[model samples]
Target: MSYEECVIVDIDGTLAEFDAEAVRQWVLGEEKQWLPFFEHMAQALPGVAVARLVGILSAQQQKIVICSGRPASYQHYTQTWLEQHSIPFDALYLRPDDEDHLADEVVKKRLLQRIREDGYQPWLVIDDRQAVVDFWRAEGLTCLQCAPGDF
Candidate 1:
């Protein structure tokens, strides 16, 4: 017999779009222009749609972990965003204890190592990053790409 595994989600695209206004506020000196571009990268899940998706995933009782390239603080933003949108997920995986840890390739490798060692083997992983799918698959994890409009 086999046990049901968890589901890992990506913040941008897979569920919600990056908050440009939020990111814009952080772009202080040289990064102002890039702020608006964040909007192009993701689509906000419709409020009702997100709630329904959460319902579907919750009914299955699968552990939903959010993995993002953004740092830990972003996780707070994500949580707040969830409340704003009514989306649901269980845990969050991120960088440098909270701020984008995987920016460096070596760090990413180590972070992934930690995730595997932690025993949170996901039944399904959803990500907007194709490279992540490829990498996780190589590590023997099931992954799904968040293609255009993919729920």
Candidate 2:
């Protein structure tokens, strides 16, 4: 597909309900409770409106690419969740396992490079994080913020 036809979307807080409090607690805590955090997120409910919008875009022939700060190590769970929810996506990109310590925007920027290399020219992005939204805009792509992402 041409670059103008591809759209990027985020998983957490965009397509799925994100528990900010749980994430904040985990981030503030010293221990790395990654497994539990991932498990909790795996059961997150889908964002109906956003999912419908994505479906509409897909029906219109826009290539949907699922991109997120979620770790690649838990890709199985992410993929299963997406499949179970019937969210259409042409590709899924997640933060590398070793790069989990990096900020969301940094990780996504690296993923963007990979996406371009894979022959997708993403024209728009749907995300719910302030930093990430800013990053996408800085990179000259239109980004729609689906929710308050100031956390």
Candidate 3:
């Protein structure tokens, strides 16, 4: 589909439930466990309202492009979660494993360029993070904030 037909969607805190305090502690802790964190996130329940919105958008034939800050190394888990939830997506973009240290906004900006290069002309974005919402707006796309994502 053309760029105008594409709609960008975020995973954590948007399509999926996210625990900010748990994540904050994980990030601030000394060990910084990734596997356990990913495992926990993989099992997170889908956001009912947002998932319903996505389903409606899918039914309307809008291309749902899932762009997430989650590491690509755990793509299988993410794919499994989406499938289990029956969430339809035209494409899935995840942050590179090596780029895990970077900020979510930075990682997503690069991914957005790749999405454009791949022929999706994204007209709208659905995200949770305030920073990411601001970034998408800066990039000239209308962003719908699904949750309060100050963290």
> Can you give the TM-score per candidate against the true fold?
0.64, 0.92, 0.92
Supply the global lDDT for candidate 3.
0.89
Give each model's whole-structure lDDT: 0.56, 0.89, 0.89
lDDT of 1: 0.56
What is the Cα-based lDDT of residue 74 in candidate 3? 81
What is candidate 2's lDDT per residue for 1-151, written digit by digit as tens? 5454599999989999986877876642544567777778878999999999999999999999999887888899899999999999999999898886788899999999999988999998999999999999999999999988887
Candidates ranked, most accurate by lDDT first:
2, 3, 1
RMSD of each: 5.9, 1.9, 2.0
**Cα distance off (Å), candidate 3, residue 65:** 0.4
lDDT of candidate 1 over 28-91, digit per residue (tens): 2333333343344333553344346656987788777766655554455557666666666776
lDDT of 3 by residue, 12-102 (tens): 8999999888777654254456677777887899999999999999999999999998778889988999999999999999999888778
How would you order the candidates by TM-score, starting with the best?
2, 3, 1
